[model samples]
Target: MTHDLPYNGSASLDALLDAAVDAIIISDDEGTIVQFNSAAERLFGYAAADIIGQNLTTLMPPPDRNQHGQYMSRYLNSGQPAIIGIGREVTGLHASGRTVPVHLSVGEIKSGGRERFVGILRDLSEQKKYEAAVITLESQLAHADRLVALGELTAGMAHEINQPLTAIAAFSDAGARLIDNDNDAARTELKNICGRISQQARRAGDVIARLRRLSQKGELSKSSHDLQRLVQSALQLFDHEVRRSNAAIATHFNHRTKLVPVDEIQIQQVLVNLIKNSLDALAESATEPAQVHVHVEEEDEHLYIIVEDNGPGVDPENEPHLFEPFFTTKDHGVGLGLSICRNIAVAHGGNLRYKRSERGGARFTLSLPLTYIG
Candidate 1:
């Protein structure tokens, strides 16, 4: 790359300085502009001829404009320069009175017993806009990740709520028929039916409550929660869905109860997401006697919650990009469930990992610091 420069010719030097993309401005030791190229004109929104004889400070905003001369005098007196031979980001004042972010590089030239300074500035206005655009995009992706979880849970949640609703309807009909009879046997039956109705009402509320907790938008409030209960909560939330999907769920807790310091809801979200993915894989593969196994075990100081399914395993090729934002092999929306799950685990000082289950299916393990035993 160094050998490619046309270092021996004056024409090459002129072309390199004038035709180059970066704006170059040369000023005399007195801080008066001496040379301004075409690129400088395009960048500063000024004509070269109009700016050549003016003070270099004219191109700077008030604070820098007023202080640049002092800095130059200090450099000349002490041979200590602040910006010369140093490149950094600074503000540039355009002829249109607009401030632009710029990358600035300064160099000195000594010729014919006179001193000059050359400044190279790269405009960053568009780059700033691009950065803002990317920030907005990432914010949208985060929101989309949460919405996707809700979408996946909607089907199972519908089934969960309807089960209790159907029970309440049946009990109501039976209670109504008994009330009209007004006999001792009928009254006793009515009382039993009322209790069943209350139980179903609470069950329905539990389903809605699960959805509400997961949908809440707020910062994570972490505490020491029982790991076993947390896993059970996720299973209970998906109980009706498992039955509806013609899948079986088996849970094993070797470390029956361990208190882990983490955001309970966030960890629950990860487990639920893993379960949903497992169910989807099972459905697609049409696996006979579809099964999802969730096991909790404590190895040394770490507690592991493993969700494994008897379905199609992950493709070796897609494993690398699985956790990347918006990278999906599916025919639907952005693939962010696993990515978000991993983020949640990491934020809790834990890890979420994937591997091949013994049953030849995808296995996800979420491990946390086992803080206490209860």
Candidate 2:
């Protein structure tokens, strides 16, 4: 016998449930599928005739299928529930044998003196991909902001280092001329001047290299590279920035010989963001002798890099939304750096995240797969 829904409020609720984009399914306590909506049929590649009255376990994969009954029985008997009345992520078996990721909300319902469990399932594959894309866009913006900050600081740094370089250059030329005249005393003095010139030139070159790395924007280039070497190369690129900010740096490398295939430029971009953020955090602290540490470790199939700073740490209030686009703790920050770092990591089949460091500062960790080796 068919029973009509209650006329006023109940009818509207039924209509809303049926119209939802998510698929809805109702099953009896015996594990038989009783009601399947149009969306459920379309999503699972199954017709109502094929599913109705069939065992609900057919739509769940191996372990989940076997565990389903136990879970339902436990919930019913103990009144202690796991997924009931709560939204959860689950894998749904499709008729094509592929598993689809879904968000499910399950609730017990009573209709016409009968009890049933209704599940509302929403597909999450598309939404998850879109979220990843948005993260990438935010990361790019953060890198851009960093470049802008570096540009603003470049002129002062250049002037500060140039004076000694220019003086050394001039004095070294005069010293060389004296050496040409063949006077022993003058030649000795000239040699000292030459030594000073060589030192200063190397110093200037190091500074220029750091600036180039920070400001350079280039296309990603993929290659098989040693993880340790890549970390060192990125460190060299930011050496001057670290020193200029008075941040003491340290490193702990776990893999001296592991190799991975990745986009070198993109990975470097992520490293730069991490290092720069650490430096910025340390620079703001009132404490003396600011410090930052970078650690690289490789596990069976993943390379993990952690960059940490010793500072006041991220504001506790902002932790939940730290990786979100347009979120920043610094007054001058545009909030894109970490976001972009996350994107680059994800593109390389990894992830970037933030947490409290043992040193009491914010720590950023990058976890990327060792997808290539040789």
Candidate 2: tens digits of C-alpha lDDT, residues 1-374: 01122212255565675687889887877667877777888778898678877877888888898999898888878988798877898889999998777899998876666557889998877876666566556656866776677567667677857877887879877876787777788878887888888888888777766654443344345688777778888786555466356778889998654777788878887887788777777777875778878998877778889998888778889988877755887786767667667766776778998899898898888997776422
Q: What RMSD does model 1 have?
A: 22.2
Model 1 CA lDDT for position 336: 66
Off by over 4 Å in 2: 1-21, 110-115, 132-167, 179-374
In candidate 2, what residue range of length 10 has the lowest lDDT sum? 1-10
For each candidate, what is the lDDT? 0.81, 0.76
lDDT of each residue in 259-298, candidate 1, tens digit only: 7787888888899889988987898898888999999888
Cα RMSD to the true fold for all candidates: 22.2, 18.6
Candidate 1 pairs with clashing backbones: none
C-alpha TM-scores of all predictions = 0.43, 0.43
For residue 238, give model 1's deviation from the true position in Å. 40
